[model samples]
Target: MAHYARRRCRSACAGKEVSLMKKVHVIGGGLAGPEAALQAAAAGCEVTLYEMRPHRSTEAHQTSDFAELVCSNSLKSESENTAPWLLKQEMRRAGSFLLKEADATAVPAGHALAVDRVEFSRRVAEAIAANPRITVVREEVISLDESGDHITVLATGPLTSPALAAELQRLTGSDQLAFYDSIAPIVDASSIDMEKVYFAARWDKGTADYINCPFTKEEYDTFLDALLTSEKVELKEWEKGQYFEACLPIDELARRGRDTLRFGPMKPAGLTNPKTGRWPYACVQLRQENLRADSYNLVGFQNHIKYGDQAKVLRLIPGLENAKFLRYGQIHRNTYINSPAVLNGTLQLKAHPSIVIAGQLSGVEGYTESIAGGLLGGRFAALLARGEEPVAPPRQSAHGSLLHYITHAEAKHFQPANITFDLLVPLEEELRKKIRDKKERHRLQCERALEAWGAWLAQSALPVG
Candidate 1:
């Protein structure tokens, strides 16, 4: 399937006369940047991919590699007929370079498409470097001139450099919206109490890849109290208190309510505890960090607490009492624009059509969604460079649903979104009534989405496998 997609992409560009003047300047070496560059190059545009890494670094990245994953290695779920899975399927059909690289470096993550971060980045960088039409420049792009001849894709992601971010603020005439994004801590797998933590994927959907720490009512209560009282990393006066709802700090989750954690991350709805043969009061899941399985990340336990306090509070979990921390949870600023106010459905800037925005900086969250933005932004930029009208994916498709959400969401309450069934256009009234079951409705939605996506690909200039 992947090979066919690549062949189609190459065929789409074959014999096309690419104007030397119609170059695509892609900023950032992150997931979106590389994807954008690859797509543009595949569309017969000369692409200059700029990376600040090795010359400049961000708060989260530890390497100079392209598309280095900072927060988590997992790219959410790969469960079939789900929104995320549907989006990935579309990317696969469209020949998303990053998605193919992710597949090549996948680790054992049950139904989730998790990859080895180092290898994933390495493969992405290698591919970008090998592309003849794509030239990688290692330097920071501090400002963008909207009047420049080249089409620019601003895919700097959430950790865009301050100078560039400020320039973007001036260009959009609105300060970038920001929120605290937290990273989950990773622990040495050997330190965990194997007897206390059992392996199970929720509902046994796939091979048991998750390490589940079951908690009794008393144990959960004790842990909650400790988390609530633990000292947190103090934010600067200016960085005081906004957080993305999807990736809230564990400490903040505890502050919401004692049961919030139980209902959110620690929910024990699925999988019977091997020891008790029933659901526990609560549970903490640990996902393997890499293919080696030497480390496991505290799933959805992103926090900004002091290191000492974090260790103390986390060890309260049943299996991690003597856990050895591989990496401590930390918080960083996630910068994004008010997409509804600044972007169009094609991801082109409202004020300057020459500049396109992609990734988290464009207000879509999650790894695959960011890549989706890059896919569209690159394609749109290519079409514009070729003096052709840019087309959006079908509204019923995951790609179009995400693009629509970012560009048409209520500007007053705009927040970044991950692809969810709620974001897609609702099912027809008759279908909804006939299919009363929610999962069945979603399955039908996925079916409609793929059908619409197939028609869109067939009609549009986009490469189809």
Candidate 2:
């Protein structure tokens, strides 16, 4: 069996003739690394996937499972209306293995692609394990020789091992690896004062799902004061202070202004409190955290507050007066590279052309975005393995915009991003000025992106089969 496997690998390496067996080593068995390995394997290259799980664990992940959705189980929207939705569509068309598993394991989440986290990871792991050309190795890779010619994809993700992280720092010559992301707390459903809370999804367009804790003007002011004054978890000495804007802690929001949250995530424009028969001054909305409906997470309430402070201050909210915390919000480290400064459009490090960085490591945010990066990195790496030069997605597509941002955006102001219309190539000047409705405009952008992405895929010489 060993001899046959070796022979097969050798045959794949150079069409059964070359002496040297060409193989791709993918470090990190998370979304990007496994995907990269699978792609390379599919393209007739032997792939050895190194995963540091079970033996070594990161701050975010608790399981030995590969491609674990540590933070969120939702893969965002599956509709074509959202940029992430469009990106998923593009990835599907491009034969993304991850997307196939996600589809198979998908749970009902309205329009979003939510999944049983365990099942999702298990499915992904099984796929990687079953792939004949891919070998899964359980070990930590603490170093990489960026000067070498071999292609190495670093998908170590946000919770990268410390030693490898240091090695990455040495290679990049930048202090950009991050180590702190905050999660929102979930409250026990039975504990909340439902009399003061109302069930309503935003815009009343979806199911009457979210439990909103209504706040009057005085209540909101007091809440803001408490939030601002609440004790916070301090950063570690060695860890850099960086919070992705989308998940900024409430304390950081408080620093902006008393009304910062009111205008930002706490904005309650559409729903009216059922008990009061009016929209509250501002609302703290909670969504069912699990399918069991026992706990509900505070939407837009990601925080770094001390556990005691979290309990005390969260209780101050109108409906949460007697709330029992199911999970206390905690902060963990998130690592990433300064993509704009170090990476090209393909997420390959400029100084180390053979190494490609994907996922949050490339400065993109959200689960889907991370998977998308992995998808692209895998395809790019496979093409390179085939001796075909890597190709960038068209600038008009979401993937293209992300790559463009990582490679070309101003390094001084580089920020991790989720897909947004602003990232897309601008619509024609005539269309931009003429479009009045934002949703309609976004739809137009999506349409154009699909068209452009299709054409680009057709033109690319990479073997789609």
Candidate 3:
């Protein structure tokens, strides 16, 4: 999920920014909506944040709090050389409110920004409640009209309610609203066979935060055979979009090769079974999905297989034979308009400038990426409301790469994306420096990004005190 952080600095701007006292409506109170609300409120816009909970609920959320995380608790890595770490650093420099809160409540997880889910959600709810400029409405919005006098931002997230989804379809003049995003299963920690699974992080990097279930040559072959032959859930008529590679189900991975599992999610890198003192032939690593540490999710194991087949076939792993599933893998239709065809870099829909779409609903994936999208989009919407010039981060920046990817990616093949160095513009020719080390090269890229981003922020003339 998306998160924010803040750096304290003395105020530098000396002019009064335009005030948008007029009310702005932000639909959905997940990561994106709240970020949008916070940004707009900070810009002097009176934001009405709508969240459908308590009275109405989604399948994934168990609480009424805003910005709930339905999956893993860790926010990936915090190493500056990593792409995610650079992204977080960029967000903090951009004055991201959500990141500020996340950093404030972060828990130790080696180099990851893990948090107590209960405390995180509660803090988010309290922050929004305390913002006098934001009015939290616990009502589900069925639909929105583009003809309205005020702007509306739809950050409804992946599990958008059916009624509002239908309304969105009507507004877009297309039958594109979708439901059913299948998540991978989480396993009960007590059930895993500790003797068979080893604790290690990839490349001996970071901390021993993962439990890896290894497979030998013979066992991997059998598992592949079972995965390929296992029955899969039939797709519905409207649920026909091709699965994104990052989230490809195990069955699909199996079809790629007899040895694909060994190379893909089950790769036996940076791990050695204590018994043999050697890396296993293949492996499946389970990461903590909650702060309680009572459960772990099968990393890279999202699937659309029949639930029964999942239990029967997945248990073939050496450590998962008696696994008790906290959640089952299943596939559902996800819907999004061709963002390149519908939205600008600022996330404004092309045909209607007053409307913006954020989060997974806009074809961006992962939690933090979605939050970054909202935070940036919110700033743009605030600029639009105040009639100020819109700002875009330099292409060298992570935020700019994401904005460019969603707005300029080939519409026909558009898929959800996570912020990565590959998506950013190539480094300067003069600065190539003939570096061969990947980590050192990444450090150079990040250094360039920070300098460019600082220049961009300092040059942008925002009307703020």
Candidate 4:
């Protein structure tokens, strides 16, 4: 069996030599961690993938499955020429194991890549189990001290265990290491009022993949009042902190001002109500939950309010008046390190080069962003094991932009980031002036990034497959 597995791995790597492989310890079996392990294994490193589930559990996860998505099923936009699309495209080109699994388990979600959570997790577990160079261990990793000689990739994600988190605090010498993130609610598809809500993607970009609940001025005001007066879940003393700006709960955003939500998530721009034949005062969009179309998630409707009050407030939306919620919005602690103070662009800790961090814990936000980190960290760990220098993708690329932001952003003001064009290096001044359209500029940037990424992949010691 061992010999056959080695032959399979060697065949996958195009018959590359696997003699004298070094051990790679990956802490956590979430999206980034497993991707790192797979990439390392593909690069000829022996990997032990650790997951502390079933034996132990966290607030967000409900299952023991590897790479179980705790929040939304969507992996964000798949629209071409966009930053998220570009990042996923690069990962697919580089043979990201998780992305391949995602594609295999994908559900119809307009232009966004959504998946059946259960199937996705199952496939990830199956793939990890079948890999010869990767070993799965269902045990809690409580300390970085355990990884003495082997290369360690910390992809434990935002819901890292307390013991491991404490150890990390001790290692990094920083106490402010955690933040809060929220999850949106999901509703049964049969509960939506088809007459009240119209199906359409924003700006007609993709297939009419979203169910928009258009609101009149009076309905918007009533809903806002309910949201403001809704009973909220009290935060524990230790869980208190400013919420990450990117994942702010609905109530938190409402606290800023009455019009804040109208301008933010609930904005009606680019969406016209079929009944009224004009833009409504505001709208709440519901995205498909799974391939079966049994449920839909309230896009950008995350809140920390009590479930009862949440139901009451949410039902005030135009089409959700009869909505049967499959899951209520909840908030959880999302712990992440201050990466700029500790991590290099290659995702290695400055104080300890052997220790690499990836995923949400590494301070990059969004699903695709976490996978990108893991891919890089795993590849770098494999290269280091082979005594080769790890090369980062070009700064012009989305991968490099995300790495640069995490490692070089102002430490005092450091926060997690989702992939955005702003993070990538701006186009040349001459070109920018010549091409004044923002979309056109982004197109050029994507073109340049793909070119650089291909060149980097060719030169790097990591395996392309």
Instruction: Estimate the Cα RMSD of every predicted model relative to the unseen true structure.
Output: 5.1, 4.5, 6.1, 4.7
How much lDDT does each candidate structure score? Answer: 0.88, 0.77, 0.76, 0.88
* Number of backbone-clashing residue pairs for each candidate, in the order shown: 0, 6, 11, 0
Give the per-residue lDDT of model 3 (tens digit) for 159-267. 7888988877666664453434556678898999898787877776677778888888888888878888888887766566467667667788788877777778788
lDDT of 4 by residue, 244-301 (tens): 8888899999989999999999999989777778998999999887878889989888
TM-score of each: 0.94, 0.87, 0.87, 0.94
Comparison by lDDT, 2 against 4, better one: 4
Clashes of 4: 0
Q: How much does candidate 3 score in TM-score? A: 0.87
Question: Could you tell me how far off, in angstroms, the CA of residue 241 lies in candidate 4 after the best superposition?
Answer: 3.1
Which digits, one per residue and each the tens of the lDDT, describe model 1 over residues 255-351? Answer: 9888999899899988679888999999999998888889999989889899999999999999999999989998889899999998888998888
lDDT of 1: 0.88
Off by over 4 Å in 3: 1-20, 54-64, 104-111, 166-182, 459-465
RMSD (CA, angstroms), candidate 3: 6.1
Cα lDDT for residue 457, candidate 3: 75
Q: Model 4 off-target regions past 4 Å?
A: 1-19, 146-148
- Model 1: how far is 76 from its true place, Å? 1.4
